[model samples]
Target: MNTFHLGLIINPLAGLGGTAALKGSDGVAQEALALGAEPRAAERTRIALECLRPVAERVTFLTFPGPMGADLLAQLGFAHQVLGSLENGATCADDTRQAMRLLQEIGCALILFAGGDGTARDICAAAREGQPVLGIPAGVKIHSGVYAISPRAAGELTRRLVEGGLVRLASGEVRDLDEAALRQGKVSARWYGELTVPEEGGFMQHVKQAGMESEELVLVDLADWLRDSWEEGVRYVFGPGSTLHGLAANLSLHTTLLGVDVIENGQVIAHDVTERELFNLVDGYPARLLVTAIGGQGHIIGRGNQQISPRVLRAIGLEHLRVVASKRKLGTLEGRPLLVDSGDPLLDDTFPDAVRVWAGYREELLYPVGWGS
Candidate 1:
């Protein structure tokens, strides 16, 4: 039996800044960990790998030492060969680049990595031209178009390649955000390069449409509608996005542009909160979640706002949730359903098939919703 070689690299420190409310984890992994932020890369990689279990005997994984890859592969009892080594402590971009070089040298059929856009940038910088790679969405700033819609989708896509199924390869743009400017309420995305990726639109995500859309008037109308329709005692858990930022401005509340914020009675009760903080704030209170879909991506959950976690979403009943997006942004989807990948399959399944999107004043469109995987 000819075995397919799969390369795996896990950026253990990726996404630490998300739940810690630090915006992006580019230079603040330690700070995020200090704030009690737990790393989600390994667990997300595990989920992706779980889909490959049935064909395990047909696939051989080439991976780096310890937390980068081997550790989780061992935990899952997957047959994998460990390569290279790390000196100590926290891993850096150089380590990811090094792993990329090693994987490329070994001629693995496909390189699977888990992390955010920064990690993608490192991989892109070190990659040999036309080297096939795929990303598992495990990072905070996932503006890149190279990643799968979700971890399971990544696994499923890889499985197709291993099983000799028909899969088209295409160039995917690697994009990253400027963390400094992002923290200052600015959304700046730059195209780093491109990677050879599996061309499956349903399984892969489009690059995030950075900054606000051109329809400023629509945003104003939506904000005014929300301001007027605000319930008296309900706490609104606002997820990150320029649409919500505009809404916050109308209420004169300074909300985080890339972090979750909670407001009550037209005032911000909590500014830039973590997952735990958000859960605690609305665990037993009248709460509603207000989120906007990523332009061109149609992701209302699980992209940048990991803080509106499964528990938080469950606590704020699905019926109480709200979505806001411009008609132009909705048109970017080209008829695809809005996506939700809260990391819990059961919770994801409970979401309504279609959600009521507030596109303008007194205008509501029932948009279809789909699981990210």
Candidate 2:
């Protein structure tokens, strides 16, 4: 039988800083750990690899030893070949670049990595131009366009490739931010490079559009109206993004620029909440989720705001979910539908065919929502 060699790389410390409220995990793995952040890259990788289990007999993973990749593959009982040995310490960018070099040497059909934009940079630096690589979003910094909508989306796209389905390849941008600047409320994002990634409308996210929108007045109007219309006793979950941030600012509530927050009756109930914290806090409360689509990508769920997890969505009830985006931001999508890849196929299916996007004051558009396979 012909074997499909898939290269796997996992930065075990990729998202350690997210829940710790440290912003990005690029340089502060130790600090994040000290702050009670648990390693979750391997778990995210497991979620992606689970989709390939049906094709295990045909797919063989080429990966690095230990936590980087091999451990998860072994746990899933997938056939894999460990490329190189890791040292007696935590893996770094060098390890990731080295793994990419090894994978390129073996000519992997497609390379699947679990991490944020930093990991994408490492892969871009080492990968040959046009080489296919896909990212499973597992980081605090995911402005890069390289990652799939969610972990399951990455696995589903990979499974399609292994199953000989028609898959087109596209270049995905590798972008990262200055974590220090990000911590100080300054947005400093830079484009390092690009990687060849598989393209599926709802599967791959577009590079996060930065800077202020032309519709600043519209945003101000929407924020003013939403704040005025805030329902009492209802917990409002404000998701991450500049649009939502602007709305929260209008309410005069201090919130995280890139983290999830919960507000109730104009008071900050929870700030910089993690997935678990969100689940616990909203479980029994009458809550509403407010999220905006990525400017160019049109992903309303499952890009950087994994904190608004599938379980959280269920607890909040889909009907209570609200999407807010400016008309200009929605225009960037160029007629593409807003996407929902909540990592749970069942829950994703339950989303309304079209969602009501609050564009401006009393201006709502019924936008179609796409659930990519």
RMSD of each: 21.8, 21.0
Q: lDDT of all predictions, in order shown?
A: 0.83, 0.82
Pairs with steric clashes in candidate 1: none
What is candidate 1's CA lDDT for residue 238? 90
Runs off by more than 4 Å, candidate 1:
201-373
Q: Judging by lDDT against the true structure, name the best candidate.
A: 1
Tell me the tens digit of each residue's lDDT in model 2 across 1-373: 2466789999998999999999899889999999999999999989998999888897878998899988888889999999888889469999999999988776676789999988888888998875678999999879999999999999998886665443455667899998999899999889898887876633113323444445678778887788778899989999999888888777688889899999988899899999999999899999989999998888899998999988999999987877888766776776566788889999877775445567678655445567654
RMSD of candidate 2 to the truth, in angstroms, is: 21.0
- Once fitted onto the true fold, the runs of candidate 2 whose alpha carbons sit more than 4 angstroms away are 201-373
